[model samples]
Target chain A: MRKTLLAAALVATSFGAQASAPGGSGCGWGNMLFEGSNGMPMHLLATLVNGTSGNRTFGITSGTNGCDTSGALSYNGENMLAQAGVMEEVAQDMAMGDGEALTALSVSMGIPAEERAHFKKTMHENFNTIFPSEDVTAEEVMGNIQTVMNKDKQLASLS
Target chain B: MKSINLALILVLASAPLWARATNEELAEHPRWKALLHINEGTTWRYQGRSYIDDPEFFLHESGATDARAELEASIEQLRPAESEARCDFPARYRFLSQQLDWPDDGALSHCSDYQEWREAMPEERVALIFPASYLNSPSSMFGHTLLRIDRGNDEDGVWLSRAINFGATVQGQENSILYIYRGLFGGYPGYFSNVPYMNKIRDYAHLENRDMWEYQLNLTQGEREWLLAHLWELEDIEFDYLFLDENCSFRLLELIHLARPDSTLMDDFRFAEVPANTVRSLDRAGFIESVDYRPSKANELDALVDRLSASEQDLALALARDASVAEEEAFQALAPRSRNLVARAAYAHLRLQNREGERSQEVAQRGLALLRVVNRTPTVPDIDPQRPVSPEKGHGTKMLAAGGGMLGDRGFGELQARFSYHDWLDNPEGYLNGAAIEAFNARIRRTEGDDLTLEQLDVVNIKSLAPRNRFRKPVSWFVNGGLDRRFIGSKRHLTRHVQGGPGLAWEMGPVIPYAYAMARAENNSAHDVLVSTAAGARAGVLWYAESFQLGLEAEGLYYHNDDRRYRPSATLNVPVGRNHALRARIERDGGPDRAETEFHLSWRYYFD
Candidate 1:
């Protein structure tokens, strides 16, 4: 398929240069050659082969393309907040104490999966400060999050 | 050039080429051919000789004859930093550079203008938005979808973000039926357009009284960048619009496919796309990170009204209707939250009902005082509801039914099937309970003699019965045009049917009920194909729990020259599993000449 070729050529050309930064050496560029980008042909073919199995391709294709998971964070200030809308919802979730926004917020805060229970409690307790009744703006929330992030060792490095 | 050479070798190795290929032919080279669907003149083979509608988007120096030249011209514009670039070129450049392995030109310096706009914006977030069905409108039955490009603002931006909507660019004078027919049959040009989220909020929430659901997407910035740029490529390009397979929902699925090429979101939807089902595909792909519910103004008003005691509601109603209620003891005795809640409801009710100017200045002034008192308590009444179940958890659109039954005196085996959508009489869990959009449903039965006959068929049947509460008084409506066999004149009759109109519907705490006034037409085979037109009224009720659904429908019509009749039907359904159900239906359609009764039952299966 065209996308596979393009991905191949892209890897051929950008591999050496990308290895140093966000495109970690062990990441997906090498895998794309074997799997061929999940191009339209393979996608269609997989659908035909799977035939009503329910959730056929995502289990295999997800995070396999080096872009979604196990991918190094971008240094371009295009952090999770800039790239995906999750962090925005995450802020609201911290206030609500639950939902997709919370999951996104947790990931953005770099909290380990196991520690999220305590992290969630901390978030719930700090909801008032995060969304203070006083002067609140984007800067204030960011500053508040920064303060919270610094207090926790894991999130401290991110701050 | 090396990449081009590699592409050239690949193309040559794969297939023989015409000697001295035309520029058009060169555009069909493997590398270029893959993108041909995005080009103007490229043939899509099966979509009925359709061509992209915008010529300027495809024009090259050679009078648009050379697609390769046009692509090069287009790519040249993408080579600059976004701010320096013209026409949001980064959208194009980002995609091409990533996929084509174009050489990186160092870190992109922020396009000052774009950066400034972004800085003023919230974080970048994408949500696949669905405005639940509003029955009075046929086009909204399967519901409609748009992408909300949330600028990462909190709750506020979900209502203020940019929305990408793909819809037909109809000019004028076309009636609803004409519009529906053309929309389903590719008789219009579809365009992708953007507008502020507030505009959509006003349209879907305030004006339409439809609640919206926003499913959060967890796409990375790279994916978002590709999506944004692909939208740029499609900015001016137009595709022939066909509601069945290439409507708003289908186009949105294509956008997602472009973003996450690894996912096949458009497969089951190749023939027809249900907006809700398309969303379900996104969820299945594991792309949906979360869901957010946006209550319409009416929903808010209803929630507020519910909090008030009936007497308080009456006081608020009086205050909203006239300016003399501030002195009433009932109004004066309420607590701040209750006063604020009632005042807010009253004000919203007046505006929503389009009677804002009727509330006197005295009333308005009193309402404002109550609002000011209400605001003193923390924040504006925040009653954001918990997210609803995702539609994917609902029964699949396509269904198959098989069982044995009796018609008249003979025993029979039957099989029935339906395409696209849901019906209130079907499983009600995980779907808009009262909304149904079914098309091309057909049933066939074989009697003891093994004689096959068409029992009944519906060409298209769409219904939206969003229940109006005291806060929201939405009009319910339906349109069904198809063939059906009913007992008329003491015998079975198959007639061509067409009917639609407006009605009132409400969720009366325990049950959802609706009524309609419709104009109907039918071609009766029993009457030698004589066309019959009539004005009719219908009423129905639907009672549903997670595993059970029951519905009753009754209708009466007066035909031309005083012919009159009434038809009533009842149905009950029990969901068998995620993909199966059992249903029983009974009906008695009475006419001036005759009244006939029938009962039927079947077990159903579903496919995605």
Candidate 2:
């Protein structure tokens, strides 16, 4: 039952996006999110669609604090998988935006010591913008992050 | 009409002021009920209960009195702009916003860090991976399933991806009996764990002598996203782990349902989710595209061992036994192929010994040294082994038999049925040949008196007759307990039989023959037996083909009443499509009832 509600929610959210878009409520959710012609901001709907469950609503089956908002720790496969030990676990942790992994990732990206924590905080705050979807690769994430860094002057200053 | 409508609207608006709907009323709300999966006996989504485990997360408003108030308060908290950013249930709010067509307020910001992580682990494709059963582990012998998130193409990249596994988190110090009892009765909680695909391969392929079958699924990007979202929600959540119903395979069915919401994958497996049956369900749903077989360490070791001559095998065994002496004498002088084969076998033997905990610390250290030397020069034997058939292609788990034939000059009809799962004589197309497990099997027959009597009823019978290979030396055995009608001194009586013993089975080309020396205990009114005990020896041979199956078994029993009996049975089966088959059987029992011979034929249909 809870499963269907979320599915229904997805359907409705897409529809709402369509309504407010240029077609003004006539368009469906798909059109509202993708048509670009709609005045509705794309990032808002995109982020809203993917990032909500991160909060405490982790669902009835899911316990609270389901989302890993922290940056990656050293255990989060900061290095390649050629090495053993926790490489496998790190693969999953890094994929989940684990705080340790995110922080480790920022440190690896050459973020200064002072700015690494802030960088991890920013990454946690804007995980959707950094990841966008499942298809987004590591390179794509880096590219989008550059854009995010370039567009936000504060982020640029930290870098 | 407008005035009446206005009055009704006013009443509805004022309804929440003081005379708010009771918790039950709130629970019955269509959306609320749907959200909680509340039915007639709705208490909690998860069957497991505890005081510390918050009921608010699972219980319906009707079940938890304060739930309605808490829910209402949480919903109201979303109204204010400041609180909107930290909305309690962002997912729920988004869902409700769309479900109610309410505009979603820009609240939860972009989880850029999560995106970065997801970007690192992009899921382009997905597959259901079943690590096919390993012998000796009854819990996993039927196998276990996991979801694999694919990154690159179907080739080398599969190992680099992550696998999501769901399994019961058994408590430490839980004995096997307690584990089985708890597992069967929902005493354990199942959790989802993730690890690299390579790690899974190392565990299944190298550590556990279990072959794996990966069924690549066809799912779109959107569907994959939904699956990921659902998996995220289930992370760290404990399901009332049931060995049968909400098992590992069953939980995966629910996860897959989220991907294709319209598909009813979970509906078919409400009672039990046999891993093989679940694979069939996924196949029926047109979700599986291709299947890849991952050979286990034992598989590879056996394949290499098969190509070796007796002398070569002896040499390999000797080297494994004492690497120091054998290496000095025979290891340095051998053909490259022989060298490769011997090295691989020795490595496998050492690893197996270490894994099974038969090797001492010093021996294991020496074995590791041997492995390092073996690894230094990677050798590939020329011979390749055939891959084991995938479980998805196996015959249906449920079987029903109904037919009529003659027994002891009496024209008697009989009906037999088995709910599950497999038998040695059953078709081995998709299952491991010679392995059989059947539960709740019954055969009923009608005599000339027109009275229907149960001829035989079996509760549980399991036999794993995987013929010992060079890699695995399994002691094939059988355990069966049931009631059967046996003849003694020209009279027939129902006898309850419980028998089990170790045996040996060999698979030689088209025929698989086996022999067993079992200790049988029988209880019957007619048999004035010593302590109601008996002993038995049995021998059987089976020749199975795609279109036809032939089996014969001869058994000799000595009862406590100083009675001797022998029964020789022969049977054949011709499959009718994938789910149906025609079977015929003939049995001659040399009892006091004049050495009677019985014949029967049955047309059976199988269902998922």
Candidate 3:
């Protein structure tokens, strides 16, 4: 079973296929949010060898954020977090109220430098709302973040 | 009409001679050789082969072994105005077009795919990224190096940058033993991959808990573009991956050398290429414009814990264990700032604990509860981890030593050499603390009236003594296998042995103490059995200071053959400079039948 999964993964890597959301738009930001928890053993093996077991990416789909073309969260028509696969870091940084990952996220979201502190504080206060369940998908988190920002008086304008 | 035909014939006949002279001259150029991946050799025929393993990388039938033939074939293949071969090998086209003064009538300028890739990667600068060594992992013991393509605009930070990495593309599921064997013997096909910088940060800093050093290079804009075009040419090209010399570091140096042909970065390394040694080469070649440090999540957590008081630390631990502690008065009694620190520590601790584990709902809820407390309280200042000395400042990897000492009653002179890596007694400036990894180390001794003989040859020795603290519990372990000269009854004979085990270590002030339960299997000429196995225990204490290091160790082994042996040793090492040190050792080996005392002092010199 593991070998079959690895073969599938190798195919995906060769074709540069994105891990798109299930039953959703082709935004590619759905189930991969919680992927950090799975694949522990394989991940360790890859780390041990200093090699990627078919986890290669070319940054072509990564730097272009997401497929949300009509949203304020999209910066320069790109969704930075869509292919980031950094939901774990984003969650931890949100809890800490500030971190490199969180700061980078905000910067890519078109949040100005002066208003980043308010953005962090608001995210810190609503951490549970954004990440209500352990199995929360990245799509749900993105929606929750948009909802939270829409309600905040200071950050509402930016959202 | 006849006169015009004769003129055309004369022009065509003369054009062949002129172009042939230029083609021959260009084929022999140094840049062409670099592009073909040719090595310096004694003769032209011997030096013509390229290091690239894949046959598809060459345009000619015998291009892998014949550079001149490959050049001619490439020129012939690229003569058409609109050919797909130009897209496949854009860098070659660029080089040839300039050399041959090709017409600018759009003959060789059509590479839409290459142009799109170039536009996708807006790289104006390049940096060498070195993820520091993680002792727990075998392949990363010497660390790994990759290249980062940075844009001139610093709006997105480096998280959005692209990284060029070269590594073995492992196929199927292989066991650890097979993996190591194949990795060292070039059984795997290696490829160059481009990935987002954030993915690597997630892998190294967060997942593996290893810090990273970035050495920004000083290449011009044109050079950067040249390197990028070359990277595109190797999109799916395969190179045989050998873990030692022809590995990631070696390939990266090749790319950098191709960019700046005058730099001598690839001159010193031929046999083995340690990543740190490559960084040193870059520095020596003046390719480094600046250095940056990125601390790992573990390092950040340590720095955070360092700022907390003892009581606060207990409170944080309690909060991490039970979320209800946040509602109790024990947590509420502290100042708001203190509460923030405690809550932050709790969340960080829980996250780190779950780094390698499956996420649990209970732990996630508890983490959220701690974050609630942090959000309610005043925000505390951020913690910045203190940076250690850069890796280039460390001592060289190869070591050579000469000394004289006493073996039992005879005076002996000894010489020792190691092919690569650090030992426990060496300087600890840019290496992992309390870790020793050595390979291919040998020591030879000459007694007063005896011939020179090898005293010991350690094929591979690795020891990681992670001192446990309140926040982390790491297993200290060691494995050593090699041949040693041992006294069997009355004669000395070379014996083969392997010994290792797991143990515990503790950090106290400036000293770290550790103990291990060891098991050994040995083959000796003096033993009655074919192989004698032993179970034993070893304990040691190491004291580290600014200028010197001291270690005291003792071990006892009981063989299945009814033989018992005990050894107690002490060693002192004083580092004189970055590449020089003095070391002295004294040991007493005793058994039920015989006892011997030996001492040695040596001056060590290190080089790449």
Candidate 4:
């Protein structure tokens, strides 16, 4: 019972914080760009659409440090998928870096112009928040979004 | 070489008087005096050219003869002038009689002839070669004769010679003695380590040069024998050679035969260093330093020689030193040491910047060569114990450890535990066991420490599982003991158990195989111990370069002695990191009469 209360308290605090944040007030373009679609960094959505985990995460059973960490997160299907996305992005960056080519994610959702403009500014802030180095610029993020589109077409052709 | 000889003449001129001393006169010289005083009345003999003795004549009242004093006077009767020149005439040998035997001087018949000794002995008796006159002649004096006049072959032989000083007299002595005093024994006198073969005059003689004098005395059977035996006793023998070389320096001209036995160095006077710069210079001038530390004009000559021998180590060493030969390209052609050196260098290069060189292939080849040499060095194995063990020529994995144990109260009751195996030894075997015992002490608080209750204890319980092979059945068992408790308190005493049961097992998969099983709890009676039957499956998967696994088992327990039991209990376990795991288990309690559900969450630790 005490553990349940602690978990409830954690969720309440996280939800309350999420609600007060700018775009986090609703599940619109604001939230989409401020925090990721699923309480993760915004860059991950575009990353996951093009990655593969296959048979790796099937037997995962525990998490060691926390949800964002992989140890026990292996069994956390959503987290595993999220990690697969990050791994693919890292692998692609490394592979391309070998050729001296740099790329980053780009995002686009059909929303109000004012909302979209706000979302863009919010995403810029979020990007800085996630990577203190601010290495992924707005232009790179746009490029990544375009890549996702290209990848979606490829996946569509395969289907 | 000519300049070297001139320089040597100057050194000899500097120390003009350290030559030879007769036993009696030498008794007064600082260094020689020490040797003569070792034992009293012990005569030292020198059989070669000259000899000297100390004499002191006393003039007393006429006709007054004290027998002892008279003998003393007679013994010291040689006149002062005569004793100064003849009494100290240098003998060719001066050692005591005990050191060494005089060998026949290289086929010379001096001792065998009984006839007049005719053969002209060489300057060096050991090498048996005569030295040129200029090399052995003393400065400012005539050459002299030295002879082994001893009638006996051993220590009993007597040697004799004459003094060759400026104004010495040799009136009636043999010409051989006269020849020695006037003709040869001149320069610096050399020392002989053995007893002299002959003595005719005084106890000391001067030589301007030792090398020159040694050259002359190194003649004659007896003289050479005595000198060679004593050459080791010469002070500062280790540094005597300057340009002592046979093929390279002229000083070695006389040492060709004087080298100490068992030495490979050229007479301790001449030799060359391996890999001398001379060869290095030649190799750069379009030549290869051959197997002998000498340069060869054609590389093909060495290549052909090496090709003929299945394993040519020498040619390999030569090629290794050839800077023009790229190690990467020539490694396969070199011998083991050269190859090891080059390979190690290359390995060091690759390790820079985290670079990975062709280590796998290079190491394999070098390892093979070392193995071959180890196996082939000797034809007989029984005597040579340093042989290498033959290499196995196949692939395989090794499993080295597998075991498990449990600790708990010994009473028959209820309990809990977990089982695990840290190392999966080989693919074939893995071990683990989990168990819990009951009838533990119940606690209450009171004045005297904490009150303890040793109630009527229940049975002790146990469960275990061990995987043996991929396709073979794994072992599993459960045990329980139920016996009355003997002691009771907050701190309970000894408890006992009596129980037994059947075990379950199953196996599957390839390469990385696994299995599971269940066992019965013997704490309860047969009816209450409704032997549990469970099936568990395990599978391994690689996740991002790391390996991970999961296991799930479900079973039901029914105690035969009692009917309160349940079915379809299950256990789920997942390992997330090294040595740690989380497990969730669900089981029925009591019996079928009134079974209750129980669920448990546990953390487990495994050690390597």
Candidate 5:
């Protein structure tokens, strides 16, 4: 009788803590509009709403973003969480998109350190361990260069 | 008086027979035999046609009829002129200068008895017939050389003589051709006269007359002249459809021996009965030209012609000409054709495809054709249509690893040069052999609760030995040699220096396969030289479709100073890309005082 009463009291406390968290709105994707320096408070609120989201995804604040359609995180941040098993399918989809985007980024910024590592790891996991790459072609490399140069120009225009 | 007359008659009767015997003896002399052989070998003969225009007329009487009367009448009625060209059996020729004349005139000249004119014709009249075509063509019979047949001897048969026939013609009248005029006074048979008549036509025009057989040997001037000098004495030489019909077996053999001594006469003649011993000698010598005065006459002329002409002679001639044109089309094709008979013979040996009877038959036919072309025209090179193909991609190397298993890290490197010329080239007249090399290393390391043991070993072999690399198994000083050096140092181990001895390798394929030996040396003590002999085999397959290479090789070595020790190993390798490779290798080794086994894997990146 005493154990049951204590469990009921613990659950009520957890519910009360969730209800008091920031953003009563649904996952608060609009909160991602806040600048990188803002440290989006929505992720903390969302982590409470979705109990399985881990610290790698929820505690990142504005440093990294997840690949969720909710637009609160970037592909890199999502892939990291996926690798950690916080989000498996979501991380894989983000990695595929990241591979396509990184091809362009590689030509512009010589490949982001995080993206290069993630892509290499993915290749190792899929193909024969003898090589990390098998389908590199001249056409694909040129396409990447064009996209990266275009992206750089757009960013420069804004600047 | 009666007795004296009878004795004189007896002496006269015996004189002619004695002379005949002496003549026969002279003809059989060894010097004559040599001369005859040379003469027979060089002369060119052809069975071309001679054009003879038959004019329907009788000669006029020289004295019975009034010459002035006939001269006036003949001059009024007849005009001299030439006719158009006519086709002969082999080529076109023309004749010129058929004319009429009268010596005396009388009122009854026109009424002169034709019988009297015929009776007087044996003395002074002759017919001059002119042909009408092929007047200025290069192939016309005006500029070539011709031989005249001499008249019959006291006997009915005619003995061939070194005689030049009538001269060739020059620029004649606007519409007239030249011809030899046979007059009644000349007393030459018209049939015999025609033969030399056409021959003289080409001779004076400075063109090469086809031999009596009407086939051009296609020889260079010097060779043609040499052959011509020999051809005259050769007897009973016959031809069908412009080729040396195999019927001239003995002569054909002689020709082959002269032109290509290294050729395998028997192998080429498998379709016929070429003597076993003769073929064996030819194979050993690597050329037919080296053999002289063999039993060539043992095979009759009839049998040879029967065999070579067994197939259509016309077809063979066409094929031979086609092959010649194909050969002349390229300079690269011309080199092998000019090589010595021995080299050609070795090439033929390599070409014999014993796998299928069909290929062997084809090779035999090509060999025969080559023999014939060389025999007739020794200076013209013969080309083999088959040439080995070169590989497009370079070599491959690889390394493999499986953690915590009986196998350790293994590394292997392979270089293969591959091609499909033998298989892909159409109707190839020959084949080419490929070459390759493989080097492998095996390493095994074991740690029992932190105490570590390590070993490294390697075996190297090559397909076509390169002059650059110095590390290999040199099994014999006279056969092979190599040198290698290595240094190793570890945090918990002492520095070690290792210098490997030379290694030996054997390659037995098309270019060079299973026919090599090598030995290497190492130092046992300060003053001792220890030697080791290793025997090994290596084979590889190149997947051009995937641009991948795989190889398997095994090698074993035994030390002379230490008989109890034997080292044996195997290696496998695969290529990853142009600059990278993966390898796997394993080895079982033993020594005089200890034994060890190891496996190794390696990933090699090459800068060049």
Candidate 6:
């Protein structure tokens, strides 16, 4: 009976990429942020123990910040979004003119701390041109950001 | 020539004895045992054998059981000038090198694979991350814990930090019952993986809407390196994954124990290693340096919507549903700040909703347009959601209670115990509000003139009451199955039952009201039928405050056998500090032929 109860308790306890091109799938941003096998039952079971199906990632493969280092756009030999797949976060922060993502992006871009406020202001002013459209690719956004940065006197040298 | 040969043979025979004498103490060290995952006992579950199931992890055939044999084999394996053992077991190499007189021949320096990997990691700091529970998803009801290897340098912030996660490797298309069965019985193999902190943030916060608590650990640089090296050893290693004991939290505590050899972080957890309880253990060990909170995307949206006026919130919802609403007079008439706030809220809404469906062009265009308005306006302050009490501060999971009550005309004494988790009446400081998840709850009662009998045994009970509002409409739900004692024809009979349903809930300040339509199946010994089915409805209102909680609920059921039952109950609970509480409940139960009134009072003590 104790064994049966233990089994019952156990049952209850259980119950509780690449940088090929800016617009390419390798760039990591081409896929939607929340795209995957998201069946409700799967989520319920997967989250029960916080388990994943066959994800065997070694720390070695996560280059820098798990971003594709082969991205076309390079800053200090590192792609801006290459270090972090936070394009949406960056976009939101860019609109607000300041955020953790925005600051991290600027730092990755080698922008000086003193020039960040100016960088934020410039990005804020050029938000429309940078974003252009809701479907704007991350590469296109980066290009537009560089174009805008090149126009600013203080930001031009950094860009 | 024979005498020289004999002398060489004698020397060779004595070398091992000499070596064994010196290395015996080192092999017996606790650190060595921890490295092998050898605990005291003979069984495979918790004691005796190594926790790691992978045979490749052990050098000696009996290495999993005999630490000395493994240690000696490791030494022999590492003696070669070109041996890759140093790279495979760098932590062991470091430990052994300190104790033995190994030649400093730069073998470790030439391992480019290990060198390049180490260089990629900062190894300067470590943090324990807890993604708070998401009640809507029952799997996340217990929450989860992982470790983050911080790069130390703030150039990219902690977003660039490496996250270490331990989880079971399961099949994607498996059935749910099989999944649960395998998870409970250690059928799946668990492995440790490393990814970027930002990716984890996206997974937990943005996708799942679970608030994250990051606790920076205070470990010496040496300890951090030891942990990192051991983590490398564990790469691709397999351990039989069990849902209760040898789980993610348990594995991480083992790593921490390896780092701080003197700390007893893994001692208390033998049966279960709940994530929140692990955090509390870390806090008690004084290993926590500081804590930071990251609000989920849904939480941020809630804060943004909360800052708006009623009319503005309505306008924001309209803008989210239709892009043309931005052209309206009411939206256009708002001040620039208000408009920016409204647009931001709408954009957040679209992003959150995108989690459910495929990305569509229409939603994208609307979100982009809203962002354009936000960008055009002057910058407003970022939305800041109020951080609730961290999980470590919450009451423990295991609970024990004792009380005396009256049933009909009989006086009774009751004792109850719960194996895990939060209930609605418990303190809600660190748990999800309106969420109740309990498992293995049992109650026994002794009536005035009767022997002690089992009153109830709840195998599993879960309730998620996410309140509906103007911006979000989350459904409330509950499911429970267990053995219950019922009064049938003047005698008590234990019945097995399961019931569940969906409902609606609303929050208004301190008060929350909810209603549910339920369906139930029961097997009672007194009933002639094999199984009985019932349909019912339940309604309740709860008032929560810092000092106490009050609830009033009523339920009625109609069975197919022409039996009917109604129960109305009121409960009050007052917390006494963090680990104790007092509760009182009064309910009247009406059946087809009899009615009984029950009053109960209990004092509950909680612990991990």
- lDDT values of the candidates? 0.58, 0.58, 0.73, 0.24, 0.25, 0.75
| Reference interface contacts recovered per candidate | 0.00, 0.00, 0.11, 0.00, 0.00, 0.24
The deviation in Å at residue B108 for candidate 1 is 7.1
Q: Which one is best on lDDT?
A: 6
Compose the digit string of candidate 6's lDDT tens values, residues B503-531.
Answer: 89998987889999998777776778866
For model 4, state the Cα shift of residue B394 in Å: 28
- B198-237, model 5: which lDDT tens digit per residue? 2122222112111111111222333222222223212112
Tell me the tens digit of each residue's lDDT in model 6 across A1-159.
Answer: 543454344433333311011122233322210113333333334333333222223333343211344322123313545443377788888888888778767876778878888998898888888887767776787888899999999889988
lDDT at B393 for candidate 5?
A: 19
On a 0 to 1 TM-score scale, where does candidate 6 land against the true structure? 0.88
Model 4 lDDT per residue over B1-608, tens place: 99999999987986534443333443333222222111111112222101221121112231022223322232343222223311221111223211112232221222232112122121222211111011111110111212221222221111111111111111222222222222123211121111121111111110111101111122345434433322222211211111101111111212212222112222221122111111222223322212211111111122223232323333333332332333344445555544433322222222221212233444333332332222222211111112111111100111111111111212122222211112121111111112111222121112123243332332222333333321123344333333332212122322233333334433333122222232332221232222322222222211111232333333443333332222444444455443444555554433333444445554444321
Against the native complex, each candidate's DockQ, computed on alpha carbons, is 0.02, 0.02, 0.11, 0.00, 0.00, 0.21
Tell me the fnat of candidate 3.
Answer: 0.11
Please, what are the lDDT tens digits per residue for candidate 5 over residues A1-159? 442343233322222222211221233221210011111121121111111100111111111223222222122232222221122111222222232223322222334444555443332232222111223233333343334434453322311
Q: Mark the regions of model 6 whose C-alpha exceeds 4 Å error after superposition.
A: A1-60, A63-85, A112-114, B1-21, B40-46, B80-82, B175-178, B488-491
> TM-score for each prediction?
0.66, 0.69, 0.85, 0.17, 0.21, 0.88
Q: Write the per-residue lDDT of candidate 1 for residues B381-457, one digit (tens) a residue.
A: 36554445555677787899997765545677889998755676777656666777676688888878856877777
lDDT at A48, model 5: 17
- lDDT by residue for model 1 over A82-122, one digit each (tens)? 32223333443454354444544554455566666666656
Scoring the B chain of model 2 against the true B chain gives a TM-score of 0.82
lDDT of 4: 0.24
In model 2, the runs with Cα more than 4 Å from the true position are: A1-159, B1-94, B97-107, B110-122, B136-141, B153-156, B169-187, B195-199, B267-269, B324-333, B372-378, B381-385, B469-471, B528-531, B592-594
